[model samples]
Target: MRQRNKPWADDFLRENTHLVIPSPSEHRGKWQELFGNNNPIHVEVGTGKGQFIVGMARQYPDINFIGIELSKSVIVTAAEKVQDSDQKNILLIQENAENLNEIFMENEVSTIYLNFSDPWPKKRHAKRRLTFHTFLKRYETALSPKGELIFKTDNRGLFEYSLVSFSEYGMLLNEVSLDLHKDHDPENIMTEYEEKFSAKGQPIYRCKAVFRGE
Candidate 1:
């Protein structure tokens, strides 16, 4: 889906620099310092409108959350949501997921979330998928030795592809659910997309995988 251009996006980003961090790479490996605590850090790669991250921050006050989104117009809405939530543990980054290595160092992140990412349903565009080997490599470098990669999507094809990709990349699947909503996980935090899709009776697929270090 094409994002509608927001003419005030640039100004909004400038004014809310505290919420939407600028030059996030400079904080690599020192994210805990930014949060002013030793709490574990979690990142959401495709934080669409800040629902999941903000909700997670509210649920786990001890953990720090960073939301990475590429769209300036889209992230501005997320930034506004974060601002309204007034959660100090949450931050936003206007950047691409491909630069995860540059924004975080080895063993820096504890958990990474890929929620309702674009399926990129084409053989030629498979490399662009969030679960692609290249992105998995980046996640391995940034996540701690025991760090986890949790993924949720309504697209079965992407879920199957991700399970295969994770196995091929030597990642251990700790948990998987083909029908997450049916399982009734009380701790589950729903993203905007998740709520919208699950409301339509679509099965939500989820998995928690950990990288097997060398």
Candidate 2:
């Protein structure tokens, strides 16, 4: 569901400009320099409300994290969460995932996370699915040679589709979990949607895919 426009959203983003990278294109290959360290960087696309990324940032201080959300209202909520904490490794960017190639250089990112992404259930909209080869190709270009893509979703159809898509794209898949919470992973950090849906007994699906050559 699309969030209602919050009138203060834009202002909140502007005020927290320090927490966001306004021109990501300019920082393409120099992202490590932006953080003033050469830590491995992980990006989360469609990071709604920021729970997953924020939690990861807190858990892993050795890695630099970036959360990209297309909606200003949505990203503002993530920024607010960061502001209330002492997490400095997290950076929020208001950008579309389609333009990821222009935002990061090849082999610059170590991991990309897609949590509860829009399933795009319609047959005609398959290309728009984050797990589609179109977006996966872009992810391949943006990721490091050894980078991995971690995806989680509650939609069974999308999960099944992604498994086939990953195989067709020559990706090595592992950690395939059809029912994530049933196994109870101590390291699993739930996203906002994951938390709510899992509470209602929605079986969450998760997997990790890496390029075969990489």
Candidate 3:
């Protein structure tokens, strides 16, 4: 992660922060207070440029949204977008998704969004992929009972691999679309990456996997 112009980026990250927790670990038990109500909290694992979560927050005011990005530079961009809008229900946190459980308690998150996550295509880096078992375990740990896991990607191999991984873990899938734009799902929202890659004639795969284990 690159160091951002703290003075320039400070205003963005501090915007709409009626209540801000300095540490991710502090959020482990108080997600409800952060949103000013007991609204269901949904998360986007890799919010690029913040379009998806920002749009979702506008569309669904009753639901709280938090975006986690590993790169501070990209998060600074997302923070800028949040500063541009009036979204009291949306927040961006800079952190790697691998340590997801550190910030959220078991069964705390109502939903999980994985948008165009890193493919890490090389054979040696398969475990680094967001869909890998290692990452999924952390997601499962943070997710609420029967919580939703919505994943979208333009890479076919990752989508296919995710499908098998979900099945292997005995997760239930509700909306499984190999091509999102073609499927016409009402609840579906297009992220920045989805829009970009699709404009170039690429197929966008999407699915919602729910945890059923107790």
Q: After superposition, how far is residue 145 of candidate 1 from its true place, in Å?
A: 0.2
**Candidate 1, residues 101-174: lDDT per residue as tens digits?**
99999999999999999999999999999999999999999999999999999999999999999999989999
Error of 2 at 46 (Å): 0.7
Give per-residue CA lDDT, model 2, range 158-194, as digits (tens): 9999999999999999789999999889999999899
- Deviation in angstroms for 141 in model 2? 0.8
lDDT for model 3, please: 0.82
Model 1: lDDT equals 0.96
Give candidate 3 regions above 4 Å deviation: 1-21
Instruction: Specify the highest-lDDT model's number.
Output: 1
Q: For candidate 3, write residues 1-214 as lDDT tens digits.
A: 2345555555655653442234777878688887779999998998878889888998999999998887656787777777677788887777888778999999899999999988888989989989888888988988888788989999999899899988888888897887788777776678877888889989899888887786
Give the TM-scores of the predictions, in the order they appear. 0.99, 0.98, 0.90
Candidate structures ordered by TM-score, highest first: 1, 2, 3
What's the TM for model 3?
A: 0.90
Instruction: Find the 10 residues in a row with the least total lDDT in model 1.
Output: 27-36
